[model samples]
Target: MMLLRYLSQIGKYFLMWKEIFNKQTKWPVMKNLIYKEIDDLIIGSLGIVAFISFFVGGVVSIQTALNLNNPLIPKYLIGFATRQSVILEFAPTFISIIMAGKMGSFITSSIGTMRVTEQIDALEVMGVNSLNYLVFPKIIALLLYPFLIGISMFLGILGGWMAAVYGGFTSSIEFINGAQMEFNPFHITYAFIKTLIFAMLLATIPSFHGYYMKGGALEVGKASTVSFVWTSVTIILINYIITHMLLGS
Candidate 1:
């Protein structure tokens, strides 16, 4: 009986997602929600992403160089490996993980706070479709965040190049050549698509959990923690699925 009830609830939530996408009801107030989420994701994440990406590139370059000693492995393969790893895997995956920590926690806490404070209730009383007004904007904002992170990832590659040259892992020209040789437009596209899907799940799931939070302040904290854990797990699982299904490697 309990399992049946749980299945029924899942069905209802699925329908809610369908309804949201279908625009069965108007939700003009999603604009503010979108902006709020953008501020939290894009604007708020800038500094941390910049710092992390720069170091990540540097570390990856250094490590890759340390691992290769065979003449059979061309020195330029470092660049190829770096480019592929950064674009298709490291950049997108790591950035999403960071975002799950930063933006995910923010969404959970904010929404949970609103729930605890009755602000969500107030919005309800005002005839706002809380889901549409709150959730939609966040979803849109997170979708955009991944593209920004993609750009950041590119810059990070450049940072890695600089670090590699300075650290004597590879010459500047060799690094650039490796990157160019490995460049694949399809891989870049795949990364972007994956990031977008990740962003959607990252934003929506946390916000959903937070929005319905009950109890009190402590419960809000719990929701935030759960949001981070679930978002990270979902991101990793989804990334594997997409990588195998779409990229076929």
Candidate 2:
């Protein structure tokens, strides 16, 4: 039964993607979904991303500075490392994890609550496709989140540079120079791609768990827990796959 449920969830995910592509069939639904997702990304997620990025940038800079005692290590390399870390790993992975905790739980609980309350049944009676209506918006919103997160990460890198300079870890000139040196555009673009994939998984998995929720409040709680755990685990696993395939060890 458990295995079947998992497989069924996977099937639902594919169906959701198919709906996204078949625009003529789902145009009105897609429009609504896109709006909902935009709200989730822009209004709901913006503050948290900003907060996390700022601290992560500062902490990473400090740690990197502490580890580098040798004069051979360029001072500006700290900034470079900060940028690379924020752009490549921190922004995408951390944001996904945070969203898994926040948005994922919301998706699970909202859907589960609707099921427990029989609102989902009302939607079915009204001829509304619950999956397309409820789930698709979340998926679309998450697709936009990573780009916003990428912007947050860029700001965080600037914050880190400011912090490092304040702490005398590196001069302002050296920090700027090192950051510009050896910079590659592919790094940022690749991170965005990885983020898009992660966001989809993060958004969809929780919605899938919540959509089929049975029982009452306790079951709703269980679904929320499962959503968080599974989404976080999946994000980590996918991160590894993308990193190994693209960045490589």
Candidate 3:
């Protein structure tokens, strides 16, 4: 029974995906909508993302420093580990999971509210492609999601440097050298690829839950919670798969 329910929901989600591009909204309207979404979803999220990235990066560096009890171990490893952690996983995967809660709930509640108020029905009656109007802009806006991950990467490394140097774990020069040492450009490519994929999931999955949810105001909140759980789970699953395919031997 549970399996059937899950499969049915998956089918519905794909159907919504198809409908998003059908009878597309006009370019001018869509352009404005895209701008609105970019403001609401992307620009609005910058502060929290920056704060979390900086603090977490510092934590990563401090933890690495503390774990090295052996005097023989190089202090530079602190920066190396922090750089690898932030660029490879913390910025992309961890921050995405955070967004699954912040942005995901916002999308779900906003759309679910529209559904409850008959706004979506009204749109349909007016021959408007509500899915395209609502969901497509979000998808387009999130194309810049990689930009957030880029900021996160920079701030995270910066935080690590500050924490390590101020905490006396390592000198600034040594830590910078470690951060630069053996840095593979591909790691960044991999992170942004994951960011792009996660961005798609972030935009679509919440919209799915909200668009299809039943009942009234209460159900909107319920759908938001379920959407968050599912989005986070899906992100984690995809992260594992991407990492395995890209890095696993």
Q: Rank the candidates by TM-score, best first.
A: 3, 1, 2
lDDT of candidate 3 over 197-245, digit per residue (tens): 9999999999999999989999999999999999999999999999999
| Model with the higher lDDT, candidate 2 or 3 | 3
Residue 190 lDDT in candidate 1: 89
Query: In candidate 3, what residue range of length 10 has the lowest lDDT sum?
Result: 240-249
State every prediction's TM-score relative to the real structure. 0.90, 0.89, 0.99
Instruction: For candidate 2, give the lDDT.
Output: 0.82
Candidate 1 all-Cα RMSD: 2.5
Candidate 1 lDDT score at position 240: 91
Q: Model 2 — TM-score against the truth?
A: 0.89
Please list all clashing residue pairs in model 3, or write none if there are none.
Answer: none
Error of 2 at 168 (Å): 1.5
lDDT of each: 0.80, 0.82, 0.97
Give the better candidate number (1 or 2) by lDDT. Answer: 2
